[model samples]
Target: MPATPASDDLREGSGARALLRLATPVVASRLGIMAMGLVDTVVVGRYSSAELGYHALAWAVTGVVLTTGLGLLSGVQVMTSQAIGEGREADTGAILRRGLVYAGWIALAAALFLAVTGGPMLHAFGLSAGLADGATPVLQVQAVSLIPIIVADAGLFWLEAHGRAVPGMLAMWAANVVNLIVNLWLVPGGNFLGVDGAVASGWATFASRLFLLVLLAWIILSWRRARELGVLTPAPRAPHAAQAMRRVGYGAAASYFIESLAFSAMAIFAGWISITAVAVWAVVINVAAVVFMVPLGLSVATSVLVGRAYGARDQVGMLQSAGQGFAFTTAVLLAVSVGVWLFPEGIAAAYSRDAVVIAGIASAMILSSLFFVADGLQVVAAQSLRARSDIVAPTATHLFSYVVVMMPLAWWLGVRQGGGVDGLIWAIVIASTLSAVLLWGRFAWLARRPLVPLAQPRAA
Candidate 1:
């Protein structure tokens, strides 16, 4: 079937219902992404707190690269959605092909960069020799997995853009099963492979990512509309289309890189405090990340709606989509914050039995809750802005809120003031609030201006 135009129902004040419908599976899929990491952190933590520290630090480094790569490929979703909204469904296959090629090069460069420089970079962080050495191997193993995950994300994003989120969600959960089984078999000492600790968990991540890539590839290839959508044929040359996709990705990549780098710096600060502090910081951040996926998913859904509306030249539809998205994000995050605040200890205990780590995590987790709503809202606002092609504003907002504001504050409060993990959480809370305010304001300002469809690349 050809792409349908944005329906009147969406413009008739049913946007909230539409947003929820699209967001549910997307949220579950996003949770699946975080669930894999949650399992890793829990398994590694249970195996040994010291090993958990290694795993945390390694992941902190890897996470920055992985998320940035994902951001670069975000155009796969945006372009695909815009094509559909413009009733150029066949053009989406070209978008996917370009995204896949982009994913491949990005994966290779990232993997090589990490393999070559990850270890020395760890050493330069002033971590103890033992900590740096212990994390090096794990980081290298994770580097290998980046290839599969990054490529898989491109396929996943394309499918999600086409409103086929369930397949990706199922594929991700299946991979999680693979990850869990391998982690259980290898993370404990005396395993058949003789591998344990963070290294073993790293292998599990690699296996799961490989599985995820293969599964998603199969799904895309076997999609019922593959031929009709031009997936089976070569995409014709279209420089403008490719350029448009990359242009959007450039801003998103910058935003994602800056934000992730700032957050990763918090882990470095935690390491400076104590090795145990790394474990505590990991647990707190992991929980916060899991919560973050909900908003991230909602953001994707919101962006899709906004992109579609922008394509159809429906300004009212765009505003309604964003309004519904913001309301839903706030409500969901508030509920989550309450749960985290009320039972921080119970949540912390799930990760590790280390008494000191648990205490530290519990306190920091409570403070972390304060930022959940703001953090969630900021991402939603940023994505919505991108969907409307107001990309630079979000990038600039994040640069200021996260890098310029949050990073130095984290260093001072968490390090100089000796507030440790809690201090870092405080910095995040302030930065997220500032980011949300700025992005929301940008969107509102743009809403007041004349509405124009983002220029559609001409077919050659």
Candidate 2:
């Protein structure tokens, strides 16, 4: 009925301690999201390396839309957190309602665009006919699943902005269980569903995502404060609220698109090299993504804290939260880097048993380990900038590092130099380090200036 003293103390604690408390469950939730794909990759890779190749190719295409869609709706989280700090907590429900409408349209548009053009895009890549043909169905299925997952993300973002990360963590892991069980049943090729291998993995994804959306909806409906929090009913429209959401969404979406394009293009480049290269890239990227969830979770925590501080005009708190996030991310990733370096083969073997694939993935993982800290740093920095409503610089950094630098380098090293998968990993390493340096430099420059108060929500 009443808030505990300890809870208030935690809310008012030093940035480092408060962030640690927030980030722990946030990281778990991010990892739970990644684990669903991890299970799909492992199951399909085990069933057939060829099928795994199909799965990777399909995901490469779907990932661009999925990630960009999430980015487009990130305004939901950013605005909600700022609302709390601005003493406009009542605005959060309106943010969620708007986010759902925005997310639904984006998801539908992406699904349609992908369904119509995905196969042709794969064919246009000049990949082997077999690879392109096989991936088309998988891509279509993955595309369909995006509708539910992206809409569900609005609810997840709303909950996390309110310091309710634990529920999302629980719901995501529960969905993971569903994904794993279904994958186990359908991926080995003899199911009544008439789906097998990578295709079965796609169906499992659709099922799990649907479950996730339903679970989140239930949570929101049953939340005791749902009405009081303005989550169940719409708040009176603030004049600039819609514009504010779009402002954040567009910048975030651009940054996300540029970066996702870089990685997805690399996957295509790997396919251009060889089927084996595609498989190895899948393994390496999968490992990197699993590790990436750590920083991503930290990014979410840092953004929320930074937004609140910005809203309250607490520049010192904003800086402290961001700094602690960077420090914590580097420390965790450094340990991860060491572990991955020491046991690349052990790690790669979990996805595929093929000796050649394992060797190739091991070598790439070694190089990837070297860049983990840089990768983690850049994300936290970028997210912190967004929370402060300084979104343009991060988009520029991505454009410079990923589009202007990473893409060409990947092609030149991996293709022109004939270095195969190792070459692509090296390209990512160089770009990620550059992005980290540039983004942190930008943050430092921004920190020295006077803090900009959070913008008022515009009239709807």
Candidate 3:
């Protein structure tokens, strides 16, 4: 196979253009992810605030597992880009295959873990018996959907690494259409299965995810370059390839797990306040997450660019890519923050009909906007670090910022001090700012060090 050219032209000015071109579709694709959650939140919140609380608690547990699995699969994107940078495009297919298998095992393990322990875990949080009980079955139903979505992500990441974000983006929005249809049909007592409310929403999630997996598979398998890219063939045996992939993933998985676990803990703190508090925090976090998709997309794009540069031993290209990514992320998030701050009440009103819940969400939403730029910068910086294989620093930084700093502060301010939902948002603001500073500093330090190429894969 001919060696595919890495982006040799990725220098000072061209890097920004490349970043924008890749980030546009990638951001839209990430939005499709949060858009599904937004739909579920809106549909269930309007149906019943109590049900929304059930949904939020259930998701708090599921979200942690989901993110950790996605983190473990992050190597698919990193390794694929690295291989292409090394001019070995054929190797990406093996990476995808390995990623799919790994994704399957992680999903199954997580689903079973949730099925067996989800109820007890919720109960252990000291939530009211009714809240715990209502969330248990919903969590289990959500567990069933995990298998499809995690596996689907492997394919999506592979496509994104090849600069083919459009297919995945289109497939995701198509899945959203499926999710919306099911949500509308089932969430408002329209289903004959006797399930309604949050549980029905859970089933909708399962259906849509299954549809997404099937659709994405068809797209990948049908691509004209599929065979040429080695998609149809077994990956040549390279003893170190799988190990390299997992090595990259381990740090990312740890970082994602720690951060997600801490954020989910915020929901637990809100639960301790009131069911109404949980419902409000749900709306605030969902909106923030929706906005966050932009930066997460930027992070993925930047990581690909940096990983390629790193693989090619091009320090200048790596720095340029990282710089462009940071500037773009900051500018985009600042604009989004202003928009979110300007219309918090209007945004909150769309999620729920209850005056009390809307009021709570609106205030918290305003507070949450303060963290948007910091949060965006932090993720972009972290991903850039990982692209260059400086993985442990980002993981350690997240652990300190989120678990050590944000978690206790959230409890202290939100629960101990009676500041409620607004307090939780404040905690996030502080932690995110600190994380951004630390991660960017680490990236700056690493970029100054001598460059080294990763070990090449052994021949089959």
Worst 10 residues of 1 by lDDT: 2-11
Clashes of each: 0, 9, 0
Per-residue lDDT tens digits of candidate 3, residues 14-88? 778888877899999999999999999999998999999999999999999999999999988998988877777
> If scored against the real structure, what TM-score would every candidate get?
0.97, 0.97, 0.97
Sort every candidate by lDDT, greatest first: 3, 1, 2
Model 3 lDDT at residue 449: 92
Residue lDDT tens for model 2, 1-460 = 2432312433766778879777998999999989999999999999999999999999999999999999999999999888777776766778888889889999899999999999999999999899999999999999999999999998999888888888888999999999999999999988998889898999999899999999999998888777776777875666578889888988899999999989999999999899999999998888899899999999999999998888779988889888899899999999999999999888888988899888888888888898889989999999999999998999999999999999999999999999998889888999999999999999999899997554664332
RMSD of each: 2.0, 2.1, 1.9
Which pairs of residues collide in model 2? Answer: 238-458, 238-459, 239-458, 239-459, 239-460, 240-457, 240-458, 240-459, 241-458
lDDT of 2 at 194: 89
* TM-score of model 2 (CA atoms): 0.97
Candidate 1 residue runs with Cα over 4 Å from true position: 1-13, 453-457
**For residues 93-120, could you state the per-residue lDDT of candidate 1 as single tens digits?**
8789888999999999999999999999
For candidate 2, the lDDT comes to: 0.89
